[model samples]
Target chain A: MQYENPKIPEGINVTKVHPLKTFAILVSGLLVMLLVGAWLLGFGGGYLASKIPYSQEQRIADSYEGDAGLEQTELLRYLQALADKLSQQMNLEDGMDITIHYVDEGVDNAFATIGGHIFLYRGLLEKLPHENALAMLVAHEIAHVKHRDPIVSIGRGAAISVGMKLLLGDASPSLLGNAGLLTQMRFGRDMETKADQAGLVAVNTIYGGVTGALALFEILDGIEDNGLVKSPEFLSTHPASENRLDELREIANRNGWSMDNTPVPFPEFFNRSLLLR
Target chain B: MIFQILLILVLLILGYFVGSHLEKKHYQSIIKREEMLRDIPAVASKILPPGSENFNQVLVMGNVTISVDYFKRFLAALHNFFGGRVTSYESLLDRARREAILRMKEEAAVLKATLVLNIKYETASIYKGGGKAIGSVEVLAYGTAMIPKASIDAV
Candidate 1:
């Protein structure tokens, strides 16, 4: 087969491009590249992040040395037993172990990081009235661990920071260092919703009911209404307590799970605030 | 997130329109001056035109530095990724070159010179903020101005 070159038309000024047309084409092309790059980074990064190994996640989690905490006490033992009970009910993957940490901080918060490490603040622990509500909180954090959310979050954070640096040419050390926290705080609503659902399921399996999940959210909702916590729901990493309660109700209704189980009393050691410290 | 993206887009559009407007105005001024100085030719030649040897030669020079606007810098960064002709920067250098030549002509005019010969342009990049960003480009246009001794004598 012969390939023939096309002949150019005579008197055609092909080199001259309309300025407006050129501007439009260039700008649109740039916008397309930016949008496509963003989409690819978001979706591709999320997909890759979800597949990171549990061992590597543990390494990442180990790097974060949290503040000193009280050694193994009765409350710590009871909390550990409760976490073990919830762990038995969860659909956890192999090689994943839940290690509960008792921090002496007065902050009202409980968080699960990259590994199976769960940090329960004394302030949040002091607020719990029953074992079931505490179980719900523990199960929720475990759900985050089972889903490898911390690792995925870190991955997405690093991806976004790198993308920003490439696009903006401003890669300050502080920006890179705070990438994990930024992504964690902006945890997609879908992830929060998923954790809530999984947590309810785990709670139901362990206690044969879902009241603990509802009760936990109701307490949080009450605390929020009192303005004891200054952080607004809009800025929080987790969904609002009321929204989570609604979602828990929907899940319970869908599963036909009971929401009126007997409340398990808190352990005797939990009653003493000094012992908690 | 949407607001941030919108802000960037607004900045790019503003840069394009404003930068293009400034460039067009400069081009207009340059064309007008070029027309006015048509008779007083500037060339990169060693020999002068076939005129009687009755002219004074003096060194004349003009230096100009112009900064790239935000939009052009943004465009250049984008071009860096795709590896193509950076048209925005092309126009920027073009404006600088013409402005430098025009200034050199003005200098010759001040010296009562009718023609400038052996015109040369030296360009350099000036970086700022610890070499983080390109601050501006300096273009130095120099030439030997030939003052027809008659024009000086008249003066």
Candidate 2:
């Protein structure tokens, strides 16, 4: 009797399908599901979040004590005063508080947060060419507060994260909670565009021209070209300065607001106060 | 968020290309070795061949440990989610089993055995990086080899 182990054919136990075929199908399907789910959740969340009353949102924001002991400095008072005047020009509704927080650090960034709090850094402030441009900057942040973008962004993040956790487990960090909400509020592109328009309109009303508004974008673009604000987080939030400049011109043309004016110079104490602690 | 997504993309692409290349190379080597060692037959039967009294018996064994690439592991995880045949792991186990058997057969050939019988396989999983990081699968093959007893020299 002959005993032999004949050569078995290949692909007997293993599937002959190319690994990438299955991978492509699986990965693409997952991406589509994630994208669709994220979009729906983001829309639903933004809508629901926007529905939240300003007063209640303020209560939620008050839960954080990050600024509990921060005192009002000369810079803070000036920014607050600028923000208040810009808020009036923007026709902010009654009881809509726009608070300004001035940070002495030279990090080139200015952003709004929940409860109408806007934080401005000295690095970005020092670059402002005039008071009108400052009004434009403050108006932009005030516009964010007026639109309640911070809470909406938080709501969008929370909803998406909940969905992701259910589908993909804990693969990503949850974008909810106080620290994430405060430090990492990423407003949508449309939010920035709308805020830009609102800000341009308000500055035009206050300064009788969009001259300083254009200067604000020029200074921001110069900073970008100088490679000063290299943080991806900061870059990702604000719209491109060139695009904003074109849009500002277009907005001026359509609204018949003057594109050129003698821009109001900064206050006598502006340069000195920005350098103070 | 963008950075995280980019990182996952980079890992997936690297895993796929490198993993497929290595797997193909391994299969080629396994097939070539299997063909070379086919002269020594290893069977899973318990009964000894007739005239075994004129033969020597010895234990022949082989062991192999193999790991799945990150791409295959990720695919398997996806399979776990959808509940289907884990095709990615099939190739990994197949390679390990064949390699183990081939090593056992090579040992049998070295012992100058005519046949190997009662062959059995043991399989286990080992985690290398951590308790949760599944690292590799180990396959051990063992058998009894029958060699010529040199009875003709007894005269």
Candidate 3:
């Protein structure tokens, strides 16, 4: 009997598919799966979150409220007064209240958080050319509050986290880790455009026109062009083809809201107070 | 966050270059040594030949441990999510088994064995707590070497 160790022909046990080709296919497939999953789950999460009682959400928001004892300074009071006016124009539901907080930072950003808390940075506030633009800014955040976008985003974020944890087998399942789920305020593009249109409505109601309001988008666009604002991650912002200014004008035209009127200047000392410190 | 992304990119590039180079070199060496040592026949048979009384049986074994690179590990993790054949580990196991067999044949050659019989393989995967930890495998090849009694006496 003959006994020999023949070289087992190559490619029998191993796959011939190139490793890089496999990598590309697998990576692209994963990305597409994740995007689709996020979209479907985001809407599902937002729907379930919307069903939650507004009072329960407010309580949840209050539990995480350690805003370092925000002082009721003149600027804060003025901003809050403006937010109140915007809230009235926006016709938020009863028991829903808007609160404005002035962040003494140079970042050109503004955002709304849970429990109707809107943070306005000095850098952004100082850049506004007129009262209508400032109102537009304030109203945009208040519109987010009115739409309960903060809670929707929180719900979406939590749903995505739960999905990931199920996949990853999270070792630690602590309650506190999810206690403050409102840490992120990433609203979807639809929410943002809805808020923009609602904010324009408020500005149109308050000033009888949207003369200075479009400047807000102009200033924001300029800041974006300068790459000053690093947008939050995982936010699928609107596509570039839908220019906000043009869209806003279209909304204004559709609603018959005047697009031009004498712009209202900022209150005396508003600039000085913004420039202070 | 940017720093973390940059770190992962750097690790992937390093893993690809180093891992590919090492695998190529290891296969080349294994091929060269396999040809040189093929003269000592190894088989998976339990029975001896017709004139079997003149030989001494010696137990010979060879084992190898191979680690996975970051690139392959990441690929395998992706495969785990998608539920498909984990092709990334195919080359690894293949290399390990062949290398182990070559080492066993080399041992048989050292004993001037005419043939090795009843060869078998034992395989193990080394895992550490499962959270993004690098993976490794160990393969052991063992057989009985049939060395002529005359050669044993000469030794």
Candidate 4:
């Protein structure tokens, strides 16, 4: 029998490989790289986010261009004056100006944003029984700004987004461009608890007691019990009202602060008819 | 986080095993078919055998498309990061080419062709949707199949 093999065709390069071995090598290499990339992004991004400057945070917040509803109204002026009075008790960073905006909507929500902008909805404002409770509410939101919670949240979100794009190729532009929507903003549980304690201190300093803070909790507890608020503990961005009240009571008792002081009357410009169903 | 990594590793391993088995089976089938079509010679020249003026010539073609598994795709993506030869994709293209040629030879054999002449091949990458990454490769093999005059006359 003739024992000559056919010559391989010209211009064709062939590489013989053990299929299973090659597959194993490829899979292991990919897994290792992915794991290392995720780890680097997690720790590296967190460190980098904390070092962003206040000016950069303000720029990011300005990019949102939120609705300027009722910016020059008398009620808005009253609210801003009250917020300014409460903010005096907070230790704000330099160049950080807190601007209060009043939204004449029927939604029951208040939120603090990156550029020291606090949005107060008419629905929540109308429910306040007195001016002290309103001051407590404003103090809580101011505390969020004082702690730079919004900037921190935005930094973490941006870091994760950039990391994902780097790892998974280019993401859709629409998803990347959607940086607005204050309702979608979230802060960690620890930040919320810190805001609560700091807000209690601010209210105590302004009203000479914790009566407004406790009354604020009582109002929230009543609203929560009426099933008007559906935010469960896990789904809520804020801590549970009951737990926050207990913590407020503990802090007030430990500091020998009275919780039974009379709440001041609402200002003349504050319209109470909006609360009527 | 550890669980996420473990899950990804498990998926990769599964893809590797399944893809390896499929490739091995396909290779075995290709070898068997190559042996069966060996006697029908294929050449890259238009010249016919001497004294075969009465032979009939017709074009025969075969096309094949092969895709890589998820493991190989992940490997190639990693290779892209480092800018190296993507060896994982090479095998996929090679298989497509060989399979196309073999299928062309099988088509020529069906016509009782003594030989296939002026064989040519073309290849193109097929992408899924609008993404940048290649999903598969299509290889087309074409040749002129020649039937001997005497065999046709006898039939």
Lowest summed lDDT window (length 10), candidate 3 chain A = A233-242
- Model 4, which residues run further than 4 Å from truth? A1-50, A59-66, A172-184, A222-235, A272-277, B1-155
Which stretches of model 1 miss by more than 4 angstroms?
A1-70, A91-95, A154-188, A223-236, A273-276, B1-78, B82-95, B107-155
Candidate 4's residue-wise lDDT over A1-277, tens digit each? 1112364553254455654555566658777977777656645654675677878777867754556664476677888888887777787877877888877787778889877899888878777888888888888889888887876665565666677787668854543254443654678778888988888888888778888778887887877787756788988767788988998899899999878887787876577434432
Docking model 3 quality class: medium
Candidate 3 chain B, run of 10 with poorest lDDT: B126-135
Colliding pairs, model 3: none
Worst 10 residues of 4 chain B by lDDT: B76-85
Docking class of 2: medium
lDDT (0 to 1) per candidate: 0.76, 0.85, 0.84, 0.77
For candidate 1, give the lDDT of residue A261.
81
Q: What's the C-alpha lDDT at position B56 in model 1?
A: 89
Candidate 3 TM-score, C-alpha based: 0.77
Tens digits of per-residue lDDT, candidate 1, A1-277, equal 1112233242132224444565567778888987888767876776797888887767656654453354667877888888888887896888798888887777778887767888888777778778788998999889888887766776676677679788788765663353454235345677777878888888888788988668988887877777755687678767888888887898899889997887777866676843534
- Per-candidate TM-scores read 0.64, 0.72, 0.77, 0.55
lDDT digits (tens) for residues A1-277 of candidate 2:
2588898889899887877888788878878878998999988998999999998888887764357335866666777888888998888878788877777788989998988888888899899988988899889999999988998998888888888788767845646567787776999878999999999989988889999888999998888888955555445767778877888799899989997799999888889887655
The best-first sequence of candidates by TM-score reads 3, 2, 1, 4
| Tens-digit lDDT track of model 2 for B1-155 | 79988987888888889988998999999999988887788889998777878888899999999988888888988888667788899999999999998889889887788788999999998985675685789999999988776732543
Off by over 4 Å in 3: A1-8, A26-41, A61-82, A102-107, A162-183, A225-242, A267-277, B1-12, B53-84, B122-155
In candidate 1 the C-alpha lDDT for residue B57 amounts to: 94
